[model samples]
Target chain A: MHIPDGFLNIPVSAGAAALSIGAVSLAVKKVQKTIEDRLVPLMGVLAAFIFAAQMFNFPVAGGTSGHLLGGMLAVVVVGPWAAMIVLTCVLIVQCLLFQDGGLLALGANVLNMAVIGVLCGWVAKKATNFLSRTAAIFIGSWISVVAAAAAAAAEMAISDTAPFATVLVAMVSVHAIIGTGEGVITILVVSFLKRVKPEIVEDGACRAL
Target chain B: MKNRKFIVFSLLACAAVVVFAAVFASSYPDGLEQVASKMGFENKMSGINLMGAPMPDYGLALFGAGPFSTLVAGLSGLAAVFLATTASGWAIKRLRRSGNG
Candidate 1:
């Protein structure tokens, strides 16, 4: 969920932006040391794919629509570090080119969807290690979407933009349904990549995925 | 995976999805937008967007507000992101190589 401008006050937006910048800088450093040269092109392609996929929104309920966030998919395909970069790239393009999300809120959007979302997905997958890979992917993707939404809601609430309980409830309920789409898509994509391009999987920074 | 083949496949997939989305995406407001509308904060959206995007709201002015314009917008966005990311990857590679050297 892309937060538009004026949704949160300046303080929250600036705080999120600062956090996003710090996280992205860390990810950039980590990726420089760990990212395989062969996976570079794949990272770019995955970013483009995520950008394209985000364009298509399916109806969730009551006229609300949700699209694939692709955070977990990116993390699984690449790694948390590179995935964050990919997502930041996607978010930047979306803001600068399409005006889909607010430029003022770009930092908050990136923080929620890229850094927090990917990290939550990675954590979820690791936590569910006993589960099958497919199941873990599903759960991880779902958790990532819901967690991002929750984080956004908390930011809004903290900003006094909306009532905390109401915003949290609305966001979580709608995102839970939206998360199912993310989970399914993630599983399919990971499975397809694993089948057709096993080497990419083997060579990825996140070997577990 | 073969690098060339992977590149081709990825581009093709992105192109296909861009075309498909241009044709099939729902015009309804997304989750956040919907929530904003419901919570009566929809009017609160106001700010100086840093970029005066050539195609604001993913519609091309030259093509008029129609499916064709949307298709053009989607394809152009797809191309832009693809090139941007590719260039970014190239830069990162160069940086890594220089650091190693």
Candidate 2:
């Protein structure tokens, strides 16, 4: 979810922004080393897809809506480092052009979705190594969404934006359902790619990492 | 060039989704927005944004508040992000090449 301006206090926002800058810089370096030249267009297309998919909000409970976060999907298609770059670009564009996310809050939003979400997916996949790739993708994508929501809720709670328990429960509960949607979509897309172009799914560079 | 077709197909798929989303996305408040409203912190949101976006809320005022305007906005956004990311990837590749050289 995109956090708007004035949601978190200025200090928290700035702190997150600082951390985000460091993380993104590191990601750029890692991507440079690990991303295959041939995958560049694929990464770009995936970023665009993530941006477009974010526009469609499927209904959840109580008139609320949710959309695809695509952090883990990026990680699955590309490596974690490239996925970070893709997500960072998407978040920045959403903030600057669409005004979907607040500029000041861009740091927190990127940290939540790009860094934490992708990392959670990476960890989930690793933890579920014994399972099928499709299952791993599904679980990883689901965890990515829910974890990002949890991070956002924690930020809000720390900023005194809302009660910690209430925000955590509300954000997690709604996002858990949304994450299932993410899981299914990720599985389908990965499966399709696996069927159509298995070579692109090899991810040799990422595998080495 | 082995993956050229796959790349083209993926980009086209992304474009199609963008158009589809512009035409058919729900108009309800998202999870965070809904939660913020229920928790009584929705008023914390103000018109005070750091940057004045040309297309606020992903709609072009010039075209009025309709699906066409949203479509225009989504397409533009999709194109902008695609170009930005592609350029970033190119830059990174160049940097890597130079480092190797």
- Among the numbered candidates, top DockQ falls to 2
TM-score of 1: 0.94
DockQ result, candidate 1: 0.67
Cα error, candidate 2, residue A48 (Å): 0.9
Candidate 2 wrong stretches, greater than 4 Å: A203-209
lDDT of 1 by residue, A1-209 (tens): 98878888889999999999999988877777765666677887898899889988888789988999999888787888888999999898889988877887899999999999999998998888587777888998999999999999999999888999999998888899999999998888877888878765543445432
| lDDT against the true structure, each candidate | 0.85, 0.86
Query: What TM-score fits each model?
Result: 0.94, 0.95
Task: Give the TM-score of candidate 1 (chain A).
Answer: 0.95
Predicted candidate 2 versus true structure: per-residue lDDT over B1-95, tens digit per residue: 34677767777888788778888888889888988988899898865756888898889989998888988999899989988998898888888
Candidate 1 wrong stretches, greater than 4 Å: A202-209
RMSD over all Cα atoms, model 1: 2.0
- Residues A127-206 of candidate 2 have per-residue lDDT tens digits of 88578777888899999999999999998988889999999998999899889999988878777877887755654545
